[model samples]
Target: MAKKETVWRGLIAACGLFLILLTVSIGVFLCYKGLGTFTLYKHSVWEFLFSSNWNPADDFQGGGQVGAAIFIVGSVSICLLALLIATPFSLAAAIFMAVISPRVSNRLLQPAVEIFVGIPSVVYGWVGLTVLVPLIQKIFNLQYGYSVLAGGIVLAVMIFPTITSVSADSIRNIPLQYQEAAYGLGSTRWQVIRRVLVPAARPGILTGVILGLARAFGEALAVAMVIGKMKAFPTGILSPTNNLTAAIASDMGGAADGGEYNIALWTMALLLLVISFAFILIVRKISSKGVRER
Candidate 1:
């Protein structure tokens, strides 16, 4: 029995180590391929990062200016806007589920949220394309509704379930003693929720927000359907633009292997990987803080 347990533990440890090694290998591969755009092509990192003039389709080797500021701005704007639009509604739903009315939540709301999570991203994009796009165009009087606003709205809906579920779980995890104490102190239900429950669950809520943002940043096809794939910086929220993931998805196939364009797309992929790492670090920090508080 002892030997069997030792073997089972070793097998699990091996699987964990394999995953770590696989992750490291992928990172190294991306770094090697991504850095070629600057290192091999003689392109300066500053121009690649800060400049907005991205004309990489010269059908040649070293190629055109590879500025990525436009994509970066588009990604940031749409994701932040999505978070801004989604958070309040998601939080309200979470509070209703976890605090205001738990019975109805388990029966109706929770399953609905889980179904939303299971819905394909393409379905969201399709709905946005057919329904939201025309509505936005009619309301805003634009030539087309493929803009940052459209992408943000679509992304917001896609991430709603994630934020709602995480926040609900966080609130539900709060100790019963806290609520009892709040009520004992003559606090109303609303007051207890606002001053006690929300404060206690803030870190977990933040983790969910960051996770949603990370997903928004990585989403490509759904965003591409609504984001117009414009290679320029958006003048406003309603203006058309493109993001890193969309650009990579659209251009990577046509770009020649080892060419400046290909490597630049790879560089954009590396940037995304970096963003994911940052979010993970932030989540870990928040989780540690939450644990210490507990």
Candidate 2:
């Protein structure tokens, strides 16, 4: 039995080491390929970051202006907007599930949320393209429905289940003693929830919010279906724009290997990986704070 246990433990350790190596290899490869735009082709890093010219396919020599500021701005704006749109609704639903109606939530809402999560991204994109786009156009009386607003709405819906599920679990995990103490102190239901449960669950709630924002940021297909994919910064929420993921998805396939365009797209992917790392770090920081508070 001890021999069998040792063998199993060693196998588990090997699997863990393999995963770590695989992850590091992927990051290293991305960094190497992504740096080619500046290291090999001698493009100005500042120009690539701040300029909005983005004409990488203008010549066969793999030379063109490749400013990515517009895409960066688009990505930030749409993801933030989606977070803004989704957070309040998701939190409220979470509160309703964990605080007000756990039985009903378990029987109905949880299953519904899980079902929405299981739905395909492409289906969401297609629905946004067909239904939501036209609605936005009609509501705003615009020439076209494709805009940042449409993208935000689609991303909001896509991320809703994630935020709601996480938040509900967090709230549900809070100690019943907290609620009982609040009530013993003459606190009303709303007061107990607002002042006790929410404060205790802040870290988990924030983690959920960040995770939802990450999902929104990484979402490409749904946003691309609605967003106009214009190579310019949006003037307003209703304006058309393109983002890093959309641009990479739209251009990467046709871009020649070892070309400026291909390298630039890789750079955008590197930026995304960096963004994901930042979110993970934030989650860790928040979790540590929560632990210290406890």
Candidate 3:
């Protein structure tokens, strides 16, 4: 029995170590390849990051004019919009499931949400392309509906399930004693939920929001289909835009391997890695603060 326990413990430790090694390996590779862009192409790192122009054709003859500022802005703006649209709905659904109507949630809403999660991202893109695009265009009286707003709407729908599921689980896990104590103090259900449950579950809810943000930031195909791949800084939510992930997805295949164009894509990938790492660090800090408060 002791031997079996030892084996299981070793297996778990190995798995954890492997994951850490894999993440570190990926970060190292991105750093190496991304820095190669500046060295191999003689491109200014400042220009590559700050300039809005992204014409790779100039780099073919050693001009090195590639830039990603517009893409970065697009990525941030779309993700912010998606979060704004998704948060209220997700929190409301979570509250309903874990607080107001557990029976309904268990019987129907949770299953429906689970099924929504299984649906492919491409399907969401297609739906946006076929349905939401025309609707937006008609409503806004635009020549086309492919814009940052469309991308944000599609991303919101795609990430809604993740945020809702995680938040609901967090709320459900709050101790019954807290709820009973609130009630004993003559608090109503809404009061207890708003004051006690939400405050207690805030850390977990923030985790879910961060996960949703990560998903929104990394998504490519769905966003690409809806957001017209304009390489300029977006003027507004209704303006056409392109994100870093979409730029990589749409342009990488055509770029010459080991060429300046390919190297620029690697640089964009590095930026994505850095952004995701920052988000993880933020989560860690918030979690630690929550633990201290508890």
Tell me the alpha-carbon RMSD of every candidate: 1.2, 1.3, 1.6
Q: Candidate 3: deviation at residue 56, Å?
A: 2.6
| 20-130 per-residue lDDT for model 2 (tens digits) | 999899899999999877887778889888998887753336667779999999999999999999999999999999999999999999899999999999999999999
Ranking by TM-score, best first? 1, 2, 3
Which residue segments of model 2 deviate by more than 4 Å?
57-62
**Tens-digit lDDT track of model 1 for 1-294:** 999999999999999999999999999999999998778777888988899999775344676889999999999999999999999999999999999999999999999999999999899989999998899999999999999999999999989998999999999999999999999999999999999999999989988898899899999989999989988889999999999999999889988888778888998999999999999999999989999999
Off by over 4 Å in 1: 57-60
**How does each model score on lDDT?**
0.92, 0.91, 0.91
Backbone clashes for every candidate come to 0, 0, 0
Per-residue lDDT, model 3, residue 20, is: 99
Question: What TM-score does candidate 1 reach?
Answer: 0.97
Span of 10 residues, lowest total lDDT, candidate 3: 56-65
Which residue pairs collide in model 2, if any?
Answer: none
Better of 1 and 2 by lDDT: 1
Q: Lowest lDDT 10-mer window, candidate 2?
A: 56-65
Q: Give per-model TM-scores.
A: 0.97, 0.97, 0.95
